[model samples]
Target: MSVEVLSFGCRLNAYESGAMRELAVGAGHAGTVLVNTCAVTAEAEKQAAQAIRRLARERPGVSVVVTGCAAQIAPARWSALPGVARVIGNADKLKPEAWALDAAPAPVSDIMAARGVAAYPVADFANRARALIEVQQGCNHRCTFCVIPYGRGPSRSAPVGAVVAQVRAALEAGCQEVVLTGVDIASYGPDLPGAPTLGQMARRLLALVPELPRLRLSSIDPAAIDDDLWRLLGNEPRLMPHLHLSLQHGHDLLLKRMKRRHSRADALAVAARARRLRPGIALGADLIAGFPTEGEAEFAATLDLVGEAGLQFLHVFPYSARPGTPAARMPQLPMAVRRERAARLRAAGAERAQQFYAARMGEEEAVLLEHPDRGHTEHFCPVRLAAPAGARGQVLRARVTGADARGLLAEAA
Candidate 1:
């Protein structure tokens, strides 16, 4: 008779899921299952649908409430799913009244008309060691291959004071690390008064909540990185030395087709700048393996960029065309070709990751323990302690002892 939440997609969605669970449980919606879905790809939507059906079969009488990008974009479609009692939109999902026992069903409003990011303060992240704060919401740019804007609405930023308060709350709750996340985090300021950039917000947050030990950012668009953020990367020791860029493709032509603002050269330069500012910074990127009209040479360019950009952690996805995206109407690559290319890109990334881990041997790293024996370094590299390090959420300094396919082996320093 307890409420449960199932989340898919980005860290932002995961953060929202935490808020949704609180709202549902607070409203006495016991025995309900909240499904926070993703709509990043056609495959993602299909998988969510499959999971929903499975949940219905396994838990016969549990009321299933669906929300998130998938539900927001197509409310009727998700509402029509089996065992679904209600389908809330992203706009209404976090509101306290939405989960009320007598609240109206399918309370989806116009997401595009939404403005301002509300501070959804979460005390803890269930079992997570790091807390995620949504500093921004939605996207202003319409990438040819993306449908997130329609699901998440326009770009809006949480006020600096709210961000600081959230970080302070997380620190008080014993979270050692906090990650600032959003849909297009780099597009964080335009809608706000005075238009304070992401860097300015982060700087202010750190200054206000000085006890916050570590600060990290989710994926950021390379083309929009503000100067203040770059300065923070160079000077702020608390800011983790990990940068994950939203560099979808490495070929200029493919990037242009995707309507990405940054060129391949721009991505490379950003990577270079990060390394220069924060030496030995671990870099990560999101690279699509096969987009519509991607040729063998174009795929090779991306494969090569992994090495050139020194990306140690990679999130590689084979292109899954959304039905209404501009990419869907272009000359599409075969599914097999897409999958094969994705595999190859993954292999290249894996090799580079191994090399990066090897280079970290004997270096001292402050590890934030998510479990008694496992944690992640400031570089965001996973570490397994030779023996128990400490309790979850404890930050301990460790020296890298060895490297394995999974990550690094460490000993408390």
Candidate 2:
């Protein structure tokens, strides 16, 4: 059997999994099950462990190698898990030599000492319409509630030439859209010579890879968006209009307590600026529904921000306390409160999403066909075609016919 990768967590993890699969196969590791894990929340780690055990149980003789944020942070725990053949760290997972059949069973390294992100270009992602190019790696900021920095290490960017090459490879492989992803994409370029901003690098990439149909960015910090990126949002047609902000909370006090770089006012300003620059641009955010010391008023503030910021999409988390994080040491909210607040926030987001989708009725959109009957619009809204439109990876101009609870309904124009 071919080597299989089970990935968890962010888009970056998904991207890395593709690279890891290629490496494992190239290194002649057949019949291997690679578990790429996430450490964003305790639940995320728990799910990964469960998957590892299940995979082991189902494929009794297969080799299971664990890697990713969770494995990088706790190699001993993952290695001790039944049927795990090896445990690799984030820093070594992408390196070709680490995937060798004879490589050490557990060679997890010191992530904090890592200083650069080398481009591991993946030509294609299995069953994915969009290709993900990891523009940067790790993170420097230490948010009170986030353990990702510890798992990932310091911020480091892939060189501009490397990124362009990766994008070109994806285009050649018939990907219609490419998303530049990372742990903290907004913090790209400071480590590189000339210190080109994320926007500057993007501008260059588009110019170099003019054949690329659509370019998108993964979640970005509202506090760190550069002027060049803002200009791209305003003028670049190929750069998609959807922007997802890493806005943890909407309350100023909660924002401060979380040690986030941006304030409530700053987040509002960023959203307003994005809309002003690109009219009809779809906006989304990552919001923590309940945090340490969160009360009714604080939760309400975050709920209100959904409409206030015109957020059409939301990634809401019910504040899972990660061990060793500062927030875990603080007074914690009840699990019931956290889950309830999360439901409320998700409900608000769904309501706003329906509104956004309804507003797009009759508008012409460029839809990238991920499936024969379904794809997503330029705004990243899911659209179910009235009929089989085109082959997967083909871009079609379509007219929005209706909207529903799932997403927009469209027909090819």
Candidate 3:
């Protein structure tokens, strides 16, 4: 029998799905395919549904299983969709062998995760400059606008040993870059007894492969990072000089409404300190525009803080109401207003990114050369060129000459 698990959204889901694929292949199933799914935004959800429909239309009789945040959040919605012969929740996906005797079982697991894997190993097929390593699951913070916690449950972490194992595997798989991901990466170790902090986890991962290049932490909370973490980052050769601290809003009032732990000033201080340690480090943040009850001044402050904090990348999101969230109940701005804000913020982000890339022009950048089929770069900014006269997975020093709307433009210096 042929079985394929379709997973969606987030690196944790990726790790889980990878483990599931490994399970299928190990079980001697030759027609196993795992389709990873993502639904962070409505666009992601639409793509996933379209994929399911296409698969159903093109291939019949192949056992299809749907799993991940999208599946967990709306079981009935996904189950009702065609082509999904089985619906497994993320909680039980990794342990498919335990779910049923049939090589392809239907409705294997629900909202709960399946941790029935001897090892959570991922395929080394990613062509990007960085690899996303999931060390944790779930989120403790129930931000009014997010449905992650509702779908993923409270925070749970992979064993530290397992994390190190994964890191080593990624390195051996020829990934020069690694980014640790989770719904709440900052809350990584609390579930484990005497769990290591985010910084400690990075420290250990780097220690395992001291020569490992370009290690990064993803979407960490400003409040979670401290002097010790900064010191570790500054001292570590492998850790990248970039931080993506999630600042949902810049105004204190808006932050309160979002139930974020850190205020604007606190987030600013974190940026200041990080820059102090490494002038080359790129700072990034996620801003929500036209949020409920967000006044003109609140939005203005958000814009102001991006400049004030000197973010390298601004991921601006327009407010959208989900079915089960407090923000959905709150009075939202009109569609026109939300879209206008989003358009303006997106433009601003583009200009800022252009300026950031421009500054690197004529400067020496240590780029981790990746396969040129996509783009390649040392910094996260990607660039496309005619397939370079070289193989993939090689890092080179390139001097930035200009900016491509996509990323940076450069040549061998």
Backbone Cα, N, C clashes tallied per candidate: 0, 0, 15
Question: Total clashes, candidate 1?
Answer: 0
- Point out the worst 10-residue segment of candidate 1 by lDDT: 118-127
Compute each candidate's TM-score over C-alphas.
0.98, 0.98, 0.89
Candidate 1: residue 290 lDDT (0-100): 87
What's model 3's lDDT at 309?
Answer: 87
Ranked candidates (lDDT, high to low): 2, 1, 3
- Candidate 1 per-residue lDDT over residues 141-208, each given as its tens digit: 98998989999999899999888888888877778999999998988877788989999988888888
Question: Which lDDT values do the candidates have, in the order given?
Answer: 0.91, 0.91, 0.72
Count residue pairs with overlapping backbones in model 3: 15
Model 3: per-residue Cα lDDT at residue 268: 87
Worst 10 residues of 2 by lDDT: 118-127
Number of the top lDDT candidate: 2
Stretches > 4 Å off in candidate 3 = 1-8, 28-35, 58-62, 96-119, 123-129, 373-376, 385-389
